[model samples]
Target: MMTGTIENRDVFLANIAKRFGRAPKTEIDRPTWQYNPQNRVLKEATKNELVEVLVEQCKNIHTDIVITNTANLPADLQKVVGNYGGKSVITWKDERFQNYALSSLMTEQWPLENIQLYEWDSEQPEENIRQAEKANIGITISEITLAESGTAVLFSSKDKGRSVSFLPENSIILIPKSTIVPRMTQAARWISEKVRNGELIASCINFITGPSNSADIEMILIVGVHGPIKATYIVIEDQ
Candidate 1:
């Protein structure tokens, strides 16, 4: 049976090669051309300028943007959750939140007596997903932001589940200003370079532009059909 399957695969490939008028090669060849026109503009953009464009594009896509310094992030987070009346929040298990002292602030703002705060657990994924699905807000860290299209890139690991940013009514992303790239092409190049340099890559890389929406049923627009209805980005300038 295995030999028959292998022969069938070979026959399929041979047919494809014949249709293309070329011989099937045993090895794969990587492309040599890699040039993006936006790289120059991206390199010339100032941090503030990138933030401006990013905010503009985000707003255009119905996503909110908040600019805050590292020290004031906790306070801003409090405001955002307070405005949304979020009682339960799920956050990624990342140390950057600890470094920014968000845990303490979150406890103070949403005490154990009033709110439910959950963290993603790598070992207990099913439990984590269950908790995250019931949470009112999902908070995750974005390593890269594309200013040109207002896209935020997230690398998913055992510690950082993809559902942490999707299975909630509201999604909040924390991004540092330094990680803001000009476009998606640059972001792809950076990831490729990281892989080429022996850096450990995550199992999933998500590029989220805004809240999930669908308008397929009719001309009417609907939001949060597949993911969060509201998306907020907290851009830290000094971090």
Candidate 2:
């Protein structure tokens, strides 16, 4: 499977630098923002508080929230899938599925019988999108979750297809409570540090909230026309 980690970072960076007629720099200077108030927003909040913040934000995002743990994830996920009509389901090929015992849940543990399940296969790129488009629900685990905006920063890799979150009728994100943060500022700071250190990072990052609805023309609300009709965030509290 394709991974986001770039092992030979120097060689990789040098190739790009050669095109620009310059040598790759070994270090990067961090930026100093004078008006950085983002650090103070929910800076003192505990993990529980962060989760609460996410819960409150979800109220405005049209998301169905569920609080669960590793041990109980299977049951809760099954419940959500069943509620969404689990005739067909697609999910990312993440190790967390095995850690949370959800591989079995998708393969066989659904309370409803005859549920068709699919895991996004990196090898078959076209097939992945085709299956996702037909899936009734698409599920994925969040890499970084934002409490302030109720957003999931999905670091898309080959194993984690971007289409899974958007192609399906319903989107279900599994968030580890530990990954929850105050806002996008923290997310940006983290990715910046990783990039500076020449560490592995995703080529494409998708910031997704609950299904999008537009209300631009004189504040007239419109739903279910642009994206998934429903989205759910299942927060694993003790991951």
Candidate 3:
């Protein structure tokens, strides 16, 4: 009788585990920013100014920049980013990115030859994760990023595999101004749609708020302990 009861209990626990995903004991909370379309301060800001603000607020000891569009970068900043030994990775969605006009720093004569370009299509699950671990910067596009909480939704797809965004040391997300939404509930609705379409795998979905941080050691503050040390969102202005 005892053995049968124990087996039943074990089965029940297993069922619960299957339904709910595994995560750490604690998670870092992110700061939220409310969206105001009428606010001319944010809306009127140029891409350069917006990028500058992101860098100012988010930069820390570990700063790896992942840029989505190398082609469209301003000429002056190109030389500066190159000197920093930044890694460049391009997403496969050229048609969708057509509006931004992203280009690479590596050209015929001015070869940023050292800057490695990681094509999103070539990575497998394990390899993608491994590469991301070694890479300091991960630059990619967000379908509908939120300024409401500095949230960037990385929809998990085979083409974009999860690791490309999650595992890197630093993540620089490129969000066109048009995609910013006002609330988390709206983002949740979009996520549900993707899940229904059979695009997302794994029961657990992650929403990162800011750079990874911890104060475990004698209550001393430390950054980049659990995840990327820094995360910046580039709100590309269409205007």
Candidate 4:
């Protein structure tokens, strides 16, 4: 029988969260929106409709929308983005998912020659943030360690800057199907444990569930008032 030290991950996370002053709540109840896989539910709708849905969420507040598909971006839709004065950016995950390529923003045929790529690193978060501001669509990779709550926990310590995901007009996350999880608590626990063991540390960690939104203005529904007004999660099954 193989025996080893079993870390108290939950407790460890709790302590880390407490120290950070942003510990998530204990409430574990929420409605779950199951993304059907067998039929590819998202594909049922026209790509235009999907873009409309994302655009409507912005309420004409933000001009740019970020995305993460480059290699095989929808042609017609890409044209729309181009006409709309959108900028597309490119990002690729590490060796783990090297085959995947992503592009964002521009609707028209992407100028493959003009596309710029960035690798995840810690030292240039400020520069990344500056670039995100200039870009309408900010695309990047996800660590995807925690899957519950349809969240992607990206690391921006030195490899990837935190601002790459935040501080943009629209934030689109590309999460492989394998990384989805059922609860935010599970993610919190994992983060805490990792930090406790010196596996991860950073100035900030962003937990984005959906697009940037707030309805606090006199009960008026608003999105992207503060951060990226649009949030789209492209859940691609492991290939």
Candidate 5:
């Protein structure tokens, strides 16, 4: 049976090579193309320009952008939650969030008296995911922000999971200005370097541009088909 399977695979490869009008080459070409023109212009973009572009592009895609300082982040988040009337909140338990003292602020603003707040728990993943699904608002910290596409990059791990971003009705991401990159290429390079340095790489890296949408059913555009109905980005000027 194994011999027959190998023969069938060889025949399939031969057929593909014949269709392409070339013999199957066993070895790949060395020194692949490395020049990327898109990165050149991005390299020249100023930090302020990148911020402007990100905000503009995000707005074009129906994502709201709020620029504030680190001290005002709590206030900004309060406003976002208030606008959506979010009662149930799910958030990442990242160190950056801890340094910002966001949990205390959130508790003060949206107390247990009216709202329910849940943090990501590694031990109780299933229960945490269920809580995330029930939450009206999901809050997460972005590792990188791509200005060219207005995309926020999130690395999923024990402290931060993918469900927190997708299961909620509204998604709120906090981005530090320092983490904003010019484009996806730069972001990729950064991630690659981190992995090369033996860092604890995440199982999944999610690049979120805007709120989920689809035009598959009768060509009518529908938002929140696969993810959050609304996406909001809060860019902190100083980390």
Candidate 6:
């Protein structure tokens, strides 16, 4: 396995700094933009309006949208899985599933429905990838949701693998209403704040918009050619 070790990065930078007759800067102070236009778009939009905007954008991306509360999420999720023709499922081993009352989904519901469930095991990464590759549907909880582009920001940790979102035939995203932002600007700000606070960011941060969309040589629009064939966003109204 390649560790991607950069053994001479500091020395290389130091040589460049020496050629310029200056020391390498450890930090840079960027000028704040006097005119910020990103904060203006959907600035006045209410939480409900943001949800509406997300729904409208989903239409263009060919993604299914489901609005459900915490109480009905398990049932609604089951129905969605069935709609997507899912026979097996793969999901991240996240604690948020228990927080959102989905802990019994695999133990109770999927067992009753005779659907196989696979949880990503960090210790067995090879098996995890194989399960994700074979699973019919992959489900994940979004840490941040952008309403403008209908995008879900997922911060991948040891328990969260990116393959669960990309290698499956179908993708299901669970988005809480509280995590919905006006656009990517808010998401970027959140990440910047984390970095500024000297917090360790996840190794992988995924900005998944929808399923894989591709065009053929004839300009024929094809969905899910090499990635997930379908994607669904389940937005929780009351988290």
Candidate 1 lDDT by residue in tens digits, 67-184: 9987898889878877667688888888888877786854434653376788888989789989888989889988899998999999998889999899988999988898998888
Rank by lDDT, descending? 6, 2, 5, 1, 3, 4
TM-score of each: 0.85, 0.84, 0.56, 0.53, 0.83, 0.87
Residue-wise C-alpha lDDT for candidate 3, range 84-186, written one tens digit per residue: 3566543333344444554443231234545555545544556666667776566666776544455666655556655666667666666666665554666
Better of 2 and 5 by TM-score: 2
Candidate 1: where is the Cα deviation over 4 Å?
Answer: 1-35, 38-43, 106-109, 217-219
lDDT of model 2, residue 71: 84
Scored against the true structure, residue 215 in model 5 reaches a CA lDDT of 88
lDDT of 6 by residue, 1-239 (tens): 66777899899999999999999977899899999998999999989999999999999888999999989998999999999885899999998898889988956238435888999889999999999999999999998999999999998988899999999999999999999999999999999999999999988999998898898799888998878999999999763
Candidate 3 TM-score to native: 0.56
lDDT of 5 by residue, 1-239 (tens): 35533457777888899899999866788686689686786688888889999988997778999998868877888888888886888888787875665757555336533777888889998898899889999999889999989899999988898999999999999988989999989899999899989998888999998888788759877899999999999999873
Better of 1 and 6 by lDDT: 6
For candidate 2, the clash count comes to: 0
RMSD of 4: 11.8
Steric clashes per prediction:
0, 0, 7, 22, 0, 0
Candidates' lDDT values, in order? 0.85, 0.88, 0.55, 0.52, 0.85, 0.91
The C-alpha stretches of model 5 lying farther than 4 A from their native spots are 1-35, 106-109, 217-219
Give residue 155's lDDT in candidate 2 (0 to 100): 86
The residue pairs found clashing in candidate 5 are none
Q: Which regions of candidate 4 deviate over 4 angstroms? A: 1-86, 90-126, 145-149, 196-198, 201-203
Quote the positional error of residue 31 for candidate 2 in Å. Answer: 6.0
